[model samples]
Target: MTEPQAYLNGAVIPFSEAKLAVTDLGIVYGAAVTEMVRTFAHRLFMLEEHLDRLFDALEYVCIEPPLAKSELKQICERLVEQNAALLPPEQDLGLTVFITAGHNLPYLGLSELETCRTPTVCVHTFPLAFELW
Candidate 1:
């Protein structure tokens, strides 16, 4: 079986390869916004509402996502479709979208002194695991 894929900063790669650097503000300072949407019958549920909430959170933190709302939605859908083959017939997926305040150059001592301008966007999905509930 093939491993599922994940979207990391505009590229889709194997889920295991999707990683974040230590200098990223999301990990260093917890400066990130996230949203989770569940699938019903292999279809996304309330995606727009979730996106709205995600955007609102981004606005609250002053972080700008690289993709606009429509683009992000399309990406999320594509990601879900890409990983659908790995899912079981009876199971649904939990899609997660997270945007971080990009890498903190100051943390790496680059001297550029920029903050939250280039956000890191990631979209990934996992089985719903209804048995665990």
Candidate 2:
């Protein structure tokens, strides 16, 4: 079986490689927001509602995601399809869509605000442990 996949900053990559830099504001200042959705029979649950709340939080925080909600929905669906294949028919996945407050260049004493100001967007999935929940 192939490795599970994740969406990171507009790219689909191996889940293991989906990482954020240490200097990211999400890490440094805890400036990040996330929404979690689960699948049922490989179908997303209340996806539109989840996105609505997520976008609202992003707006309140003044962080503009790099992609539109439509595009992000596509990515989430694709990820669910790809990652869900790795699980047994009875198992489902929990998807996490998160956005960060870009990097903390001032802490690193870097002047490339243009490059560092782009928010980090990621969508990842994990098999749900129903027993634990």
Candidate 3:
């Protein structure tokens, strides 16, 4: 099977390797806000707006993302290029930004280092599922 491309944090990843811990606060506390960036002719449209919204969500919840928006734009561009071959010349691609606070067990929850206030950003490519029709 062909290796699927994924952008997790700042690295290019295999889709199979885009793994997250089960104990993540995003899962347990639903402490995550997401942004969906649709593509226009295989390029992301209004990416800045989507990014701004994602940041707004984080700020609203008081979670600071480890990576700045500039860093994220760089990653997003890379992900698009890495997966360019898979997308049609005229087709659109879907870029999703998901950031959730990290998880901490009851024992270490009090520590700032282990606190769930820092946001974890995970970016990935997605196909246009048929369900939207």
Top lDDT model: 2
Write one digit per residue (lDDT tens) for candidate 2, span 17-55. Answer: 999999899999899989999999999999999999999
lDDT of 3: 0.77
After superposing candidate 3 on the true structure, give the runs of residues whose Cα lies further than 4 Å from its correct spot. 107-118, 130-132
Per-residue alpha-carbon lDDT of candidate 1 for residues 21-121, written as tens digits (9 for 90 to 100)? 88889999999999999998888999999999999999998887788999999988987887877877788999999999998877766564554357888
Per-candidate Cα lDDT values, in order, are 0.88, 0.92, 0.77
Error of 3 at 108 (Å): 6.0
Minimum summed lDDT over a 10-residue window in model 3 is located at 107-116
By TM-score, how accurate is candidate 1?
0.92
Query: Which regions of candidate 1 are displaced past 4 Å?
Result: 111-116
Question: Who wins the TM-score comparison?
Answer: 2
Q: Name the better of 1 and 2 by lDDT.
A: 2
Ranking by lDDT: 2, 1, 3
- Estimate the TM-score for candidate 2: 0.95
